[model samples]
Target: MHGLPQAEPTNATIRPGAAARRSPGWRISRRVRIGLASLIGTFALWWLLTDITGVIGPHRFPAPAEFWAAFVQIAIDGYAGGTLITQAWYSTRLVIMGFLVAIATGVPLGLLMGVSHRAEALLNPAFLLVRPIPPLAWIPLAIVWLGLGDAAKILVIWFAAFVPSVINTWTGVRGVDRTLIAAARVHGAGELRLLWEVIIPGSLPMMFTGLRLSLQASWTTLVAAELVGAFFGLGRVLDAAYRDINPPMIAVAMLAVGVLGALTTRLVAVAERRLIPWRS
Candidate 1:
């Protein structure tokens, strides 16, 4: 019998037309991989310098292993008048509340400013002046007006987040192409319809960028806000650690704040991609 060569298993050959796409969950983006690797490398360097080699003393900077051990205990046992979870939750909740408020107020004002000269004239001077002032500068006034409570903390976070949101939203709208507007009008789009369908969509990328900036501001200023009148939070933990000279506790709080900030930012980024798939 003449034997014809059997072809390699059909599945082994790559298909000719388009490559198969991976589902979102199945794909880890390159940036995430690089960032994780960088974190690990940085930790390795930190461990070698502080824990293993003893180039830096634990008294000054807790060794990575030391920090890990303490962190485990912190998770189980409450410290500095609040459990670790309580501290984190308090700060995270405040950030969420304040950030949403900022977005709600800022985006509209920004859009109005972009499209209306009257709105810009009314708001611009105050905005420009306030924008440059440090958000923390209001702490003394906040304590006097709102006291050391949720109000003061929320106000601080709000101020921190508001600037970036307004700025970015304004930038996004102002940067919109007038030509695009004209095209939409030629197609009989009404002013309100065009504003919603054209301007808002076009400005989303910038709006999202602003939102991220606001989110960062919200969290970063959280500690400063908590410093005034907080019973429990990372900020309180930090203050206690400073007074007690506890480097490990300081490191733990810092790490938690940073990791939580990263996670929140990632969540917002996912929303950005979903809400504006065209940007992708």
Candidate 2:
């Protein structure tokens, strides 16, 4: 008994596969589960309300089934000789052009405003006044000046997008840490070097935020422009459906618009992630 080793407590032993068992399942967090459940519940409620209670007539407010049927038909047969696919392409192209224009002009102007006090003083009041005007309010002038063509639509979309982008980009650059700029100067960094290496990188997150806002604004304006007068686009299809008093078609068009907008939003988010990887 004097030389014998004492036994270790069995309860203190670590199980070989215990960690494996305790590993998270699908890593599904509570928030994600709740969000998914909420979406499903919303769809279920919508289906029940529209299908069961004929509270609104089919012509006025069609059922979900009716809208789905119309969507399928449009997908297969096309809308007014052009399929939803074609209309979507047309709308997408217009949005891209307008967005590109806004980016090209807005970024440089925003940088100027952020960098130079004189430029900011000269332009800030003009931007404040112009930004407040609704894109829809510009419709009549766009039509008169650019005609009821692609130009009018593109201009409207550009106007809707430009303000947010410029404002956000300007804010981002202006908000850069002053101490960082001072440090850069103390290290013998020139104005160009400081801007290119430090300021631009620091301002990128805010610029991306502005770009996201601009994309949404542009998309909304595109629809409004198309609704006013256009031969092709999702908005035009909706307009035609309205004229025909076809609630089902209208609902289908609405769904298409929602889907497209969501897709664009996701695209912007992806771009933001890639461009601003420093952001959490």
Please report how far candidate 1 places residue 82 from its true position, in Å: 1.6
Estimate the Cα RMSD of every predicted model relative to the unseen true structure. Answer: 6.5, 7.6
Tens-place lDDT digits, model 1, residues 38-139 = 989999999899968999998999997788876876688867887889889988888899899889999999899987889999999999889998988877
TM-scores of all candidate predictions against the true structure: 0.87, 0.86
lDDT of 1: 0.85
Residue pairs in collision within model 1: none
Local error of candidate 1 at residue 249 (angstroms):
0.6
The lDDT per prediction is 0.85, 0.85
* TM-score, cand. 1 vs. native: 0.87
TM-score of 2: 0.86
- The digit string of per-residue lDDT tens for model 2 on 69-162 reads 8888889998755788998888888998998898888888999899999999999988888877997899889999988789999899889888
